[model samples]
Target: MDFGFTDEQKILRQTFKKFCEKELTREYVAWMDENCDFIPDELYKKLADLGLFGMIIPEEYGGSGMTFTDYMIAMEELSTASVAAGICAGLAVSFGAKVIGGMGNEEQRRFHLPKMAAGETKYCLALTEPGGGTDIINAMKTTAVKKGDNYVLNGQKVFISGGNVADYMLVVALTDPKAAKRTKAMSVFVVDAKTPGITVNLIKKVCIHACGTTEIFFEDVVVPAENMLGVENNGWNKLVDVLNPERIGTAMLSLGIAKAAYQAAHEYSLERYAFGKPIGSFMVLQHYLADMLIEIENATNLIYKCCYLMENGLPYHMEAAMAKIVAGRASEIAAIKGMEILGGYGVCMEYDLQRHFRDYKQMVFSPISDEMAKNMIAQWTGLPKSY
Candidate 1:
């Protein structure tokens, strides 16, 4: 089988890599991470100008309507420079392309797609709750009741990325907690973030500080019936479509962080001197960097292949889970080894490695934890359900 980026994909990568080199210098990225919890408006606008916020949107909606592989390619490249920046783009792109473009009704599509494509709108997803993550559906306490012509929602969502800054939120809630089939008891709503009774509070975290995580409270928020996505009480069917891509995207995030960490550690090893010579001369340091590169390359290949399978209409869930698991571990290892290689400098604010060291950790449990991925993978491989 041929294994290479298409000419267009290569150009896409080069263009984005250039953008990162020019606008996302290490110092600047670190500054944003230190001082901001949301993407700066100017930088967000620049990303829009670069077409990152609309790559997967249909051309008719003013988007490129690109393939999943292309989205992954851009994600991996963007994350290499700054994962927080990449995440801001990722959430918007997925909401526009997947939710509105693929699952939204015609009116919803017409209303949201063009604005999202132009970066005139931003989005956040509220799926996880205070009670659970992997088992969120069964543990969900958020409820939505039909009222006249609208759905009145009352619930809380935690770990909502970019919620405070988003123009809209895709909320998952229980519409029929007593439904015989638990999977069909829930539905999704696209709600205005400024809707009355919606309260947002930011959650402080140690990594990826540039993109704030949040806990949101919806106290009888009213949403029109037209805003419900897909068939009512069948959000699980639709959510799967949104989530598989997110898993693959998470893998790309890990690979990007690994790439950044590896570069920092490699450069530092050659420049930092100890025992009258460069640290590069030490065999142990060489092994650390070498292993790190191997993990990054291996994880990258797996991630890309998963994206390709998804783009080509092949079964990709198992592979997506595996990719997330492999890439997350790879990134965690690369970050730790990066810190080890940089020694004390790894923890210092002036060194990018420290950011890499701190930031590579979120993926270990986000989107889907590595442990959760393993649980699903085990079942896929003919093992009994373990979780």
Candidate 2:
């Protein structure tokens, strides 16, 4: 195994890190976190101009057509500065534009990809409904009935990220309720955000507030038949296709957050003194930093392995799940250790470590929980399915 970034990849990583350091300053991140609003148009446009939102898109569609590994490098750097900003940029390109790129008809791609790549349009995925959570595929309550040329959609989706300001949403709904299999009963459709009878209410959270999670209600919203992605009743498979990349992206984001927390704690240990001695001089504190470093290294390796598999068109579902579980827990552990090192400063909003702790805590339960990930591994290992 090469086990090293290419020269170009190294350059790209440094470039993005510099961009984050310059643009994603603490003041800007603090302002957005406090406001809890959608990412500002100016900031989105700046990211677009920097080509941050088009890494995975093909050049023909106004993107850079970069590999998944390149995208991961960018995600880690951006997320190190701010997880909320990283998610906004990464999702806009990956989960947001990827479905259309992979499943949409030629005309659909022509219509959506360029604008999405340019950040002129923002997209969100609506899959989880009230009480669905991780059981979304089976507990989905949304329904879409095909009419003459359009599908009338009804039902509600909760905890949808970017829903409030998204220009459009890729919505999954039950279209064949009587199908023998639950997976065969669902379909995916693109619905305009401004369509009639659609309501979006922002859900406030203790972390990553600027990402704009919301509850979206749909009542008789009409969507053109052409808006359907892939084959009817195959939305489940399409969902599976998109999830590997999303999970890997989530892992990279967690790794970034862990790195940030580790850096903060390391710097504080060197500078902060107790009993007329630097905290870094304590053997116990040294061990904590060492553990944090090891966790970050392990998570980074797993994430890069997933990225490599994805870029090379290899099967990565199991690996992605593993990466998510490892990275998520690693980030949580790093944050907790970092907090312990900082003591009172860790809980104070004045220090960024508190935000890292909060955000990493939330990540532990999202993008597939640790329990679900272990269950997947068990199934893949020829064990009985659990949950």
> Number of clashes in model 2?
0
Q: What TM-score does prediction 2 earn?
A: 0.98
**Which ranges in model 1 have alpha carbons more than 4 Å from their true place?**
none
Name the TM-score of candidate 1: 0.98
Q: Model 2's lDDT to the true fold? A: 0.87
For candidate 2, lDDT tens digit of each residue in 280-343?
A: 9999999999999998999999999988887788888899998898888778888999999998
Model 2 segments beyond 4 Å from truth? none
- lDDT for 221 in candidate 2 is 96
Q: Rate the local accuracy (lDDT) of all candidates.
A: 0.88, 0.87
